[model samples]
Target: MLTEEEKNAGLVGRIIPINIEEQMKTAYIDYSMSVIVSRALPDVRDGLKPVHRRILYDMSAELNLSSDKPTRKSARIVGDVLGKFHPHGDSSVYDAMVRLAQEWSMRYPLVDGQGNFGSMDGDSPAAMRYTEARMKKITDEVMADIEKETIDWTLNFDDTIPEPTVLPTKIPLLLVNGASGIAVGMATNMAPHNLCEVVDACCAYIDNPEIECEELLQYVKGPDFPTGGLIYGYDGVREALLTGRGRVMMRARTEIEHTASGRECIVITEIPYMVNKAEMIKKIADLINDKKIEGISYINDESDRNGLRIIIILKQDAVASVVLNTLYKNTPLQTSFAVNNIALVKGRPMLLNLRELIRHFVEHRHDVVVRRTRFDLRKAEERLHIVQGLLIAQDNIDEIVHIIRSSQTPDAAKERMMERFGLSDLQSAAIIDMRLRALTGLERGKLDAEREELEKRIAYFREVLASRDEQMRVIREELIEMKEKYGDERRTEIIYASEEFNPEDFYADEDMVITMSHMGYIKRTPLAEYRTQHRGGVGVKGSATRDEDFIEHIYVASMHATMMFFTEKGRCYWLKVYDIPEGTRSSKGRAIQNLI
Candidate 1:
């Protein structure tokens, strides 16, 4: 007889047979799909994942947390979301909320958080109970008109409440906010773009649906990171925009400033997005310690609320450019964001290029406009019916008064008015319910004016619904409005970047013992390797040379210190200790003539 576990695994009475290998493969695939769809990837429409969407919706709709509303404790919002909609851990919900609030993280932060959210130094945000959060004004645009039935809705995880499948965003949030995620066998990292640049590019694409990515590049140069940095590799950006994938190099913007002591300091006022200032300093210190980089004498993070300032003091006459370049090469000061524009498109994951992304946004805008217009039209028509009834009652003031006074009940008066005025049941009800003050001259005139404006607006909405060009015009106008209000200068700058850079940078400026041979051979070995011994102990041989060549001279210097050389011809030349051929204590050195 099989064990209980084996019996359960294998075919038993009323049990179905299946291959274990196939089941494992299928289960893993299913789990991967679930993670990719529900956890990692964002929707192309709103540029938000399930958890993010739930938090925003719960905050905005359920909690009535608008941009102007008083901020509520993050713990409350997190708890509500976890209990009602998301059904996820409190940390995940709070983290998503925190990222939405962090200006360093999101190009356009959705949440207006009070108290400490976090810092660019990669500090953790305050506890949920400690922080307060509310929606930002622009997030209104993201969740705009959602209540007007502009987008599809889905039941929550528990099937108790309905939630929007995607937000009815006014702008192309995908480009504006960007996204980053890593899933099984795949990952996505979309760099944020400038609001103005993105809007202009979107409008350009709208004008010419066949517009190439290069043409769009005219409007949108490259990624506009929230934490401003100097972007290089324009070609890489263009390729990413065109093909949905490429790597754009980012270098921290730094200025070489003169300190009080007249020493030149590399002041890093800005850095690449997501680089922690504290960790970056530690990394540079590590590089200096490990003999991987040279010339940095001291590093201090003088960052404050005013702005980020990481001061890297250099040695006297140290090549600032070389030191900066070395820092860029070895640290997070220079980084590359790999653009993989993957997002969920209509419940399926898809990689979209620039034009496709713009087109999706424009299409969503058009759909939203249509739904909004219809909803508005229905509301205006209903109000128009009530207003028309009021106007009719105002016109027949005597008859309405007589009918109301003669009837014993309100229902009898409503029936009599409907029969006499040829009004619909709703119109008759409005007439019977009319306030006495509404019959005044001012009220009648206000009603007439409202009626005229409603008719005019209703006609315009119909026209917009009828023509695609008109719809596009509205999109263009709104984009321009958004640009005028929210758009600012692009933070990240793109320049032509050469791919090839020196691989070998300066190492630690460590003390070393230099030795030369009569044959003009030279070598350097660490000074520490020469051990101190009793007077009777012979000095350690620091170099190996040819039989005919003996050690003529030795000097103690740092690896980065300059070495002056005088030839027999009375000519002088200089070389750094690192420039000399490095050799072990027993290794013969190479000829200096070959090195120079």
Candidate 2:
């Protein structure tokens, strides 16, 4: 088809319309793939992405591996990584490095960088090349294994650089201290766990591969965030671990403190993880500025080099309970972390249940063990074959010497021995190499012993290979049992599991006074005070004054409303005072009415 404009210009233009829906879908798919590959997917061992892993590796390579040392300028490390391995700009890399080193940011720091890598006070780090960098020992050890081919590798965008597909983590990092990331349509926010508990769980799995998830829970109770808040309920933790989706509640710590100035203050020591310190401080300041709080003189952040010490100074007469309640009602002091994502097997995005993640890791480890064992077995078999050949030629020293001196290669010598002795390849290779002259007299026995050891190892390898499936099945069954026992969905709210108690002495005396009034104000008077002040009233007897006078008090629950009024004359009336003008006095009258 051709448009009118094409006809006017004496040219024909074909019109091929595109399906907008199809185009949009294609674009979205591309975007999602980009996010999944570039942003998420923690390397199994190091538990970090390309950029994060590179930053740590570069820091370790440049800075001294000690947090105790004076911190290196962060800029220096950023420059090294960007210039060498990571092609990203200095600013982005530096920001990420600073975040990792900042204690307030990450639950567990992968880099122990020193200097002003920024502060929890919303401070940014200095420029790249100015701030020095160093790696934490944990990062160093983890990355060191990378060079040993413990993990797979893939090419970079240009295929000029090689990057690890995933790290060969010796530990179950997913549970040790969990991870969080957002990629494409998926995101991850696993909670940090207790180190001791995780180690125990891993050891349990190893000892009895058939251990159930429920049994494992006995060792690992629940996620233990570094922030040290109560888990409230374990159901969410269990669900997230099991199915990789749940929520958990967290609350800030607050306490009442008596200041040296003879006034009270509310002190906040710890905050929830990832809570913005600057924003929180500003919010509190706004509350004070608005006069929403009573008797709050000032708010100060005494949080210094020592630690976090947010002090809310109160007026000398302010009620502490009211102040505390106001804080809870107003701020992000209490929040919840929603966990609903998973990262596993490098680039493969799996919706992991707690049991599923553990199973995946176990499977990977099993593969590694099998591959290592096979490699070991192959080398041992080769050595055993050579020893067998030497054993067969033990009596023919001259012939063996002739074969060795005459043959041009190890294989050639073995072949000649095999034909001359009418022996198998293994026997021929063993005899050709087992000559005492092949080693000094002292080492000859040692060589023979090594030959026997190699033969035994080969036999063992064959036996293990034959029983591999049965062993793996046993391990898998044990892990499944552990998961069943401990893996459960989190019920975030608190649960109290006990019967209610009723006690005879539960009731206490009520010191409260109740009054019935038709007006907004009800007056109360103490007898002793009234007697002392109104002793000379007309028509009042001396004994009457002592009995009837009371201290003056008023209770006004609300203004402009009908009130029920009760009087000393043993009368009651309902007064409609909602329209009564302020400062007006009512006639002193008493009336009584009874319902029919």
Q: Model 2 off-target regions past 4 Å?
A: 1-21, 41-46, 53-86, 140-150, 203-218, 230-239, 304-306, 344-348, 378-596
Q: Evaluated with lDDT, which candidate comes out highest?
A: 1
Q: How close is each model in CA RMSD to the real structure?
A: 6.6, 9.6
Clashing pairs in 1: none
The lDDT for every candidate, in the order shown, is 0.87, 0.60
Model 2 earns a TM-score of: 0.65
Candidate 1 residues 60-102, lDDT tens each? 9999899989999999999999988888778889989999999
Error of 1 at 277 (Å): 1.3
Backbone clashes under 3 angstroms, per model: 0, 61
Q: Considering summed lDDT, which 10 consecutive residues are worst modelled in model 1?
A: 500-509
- Number of the top TM-score candidate: 1
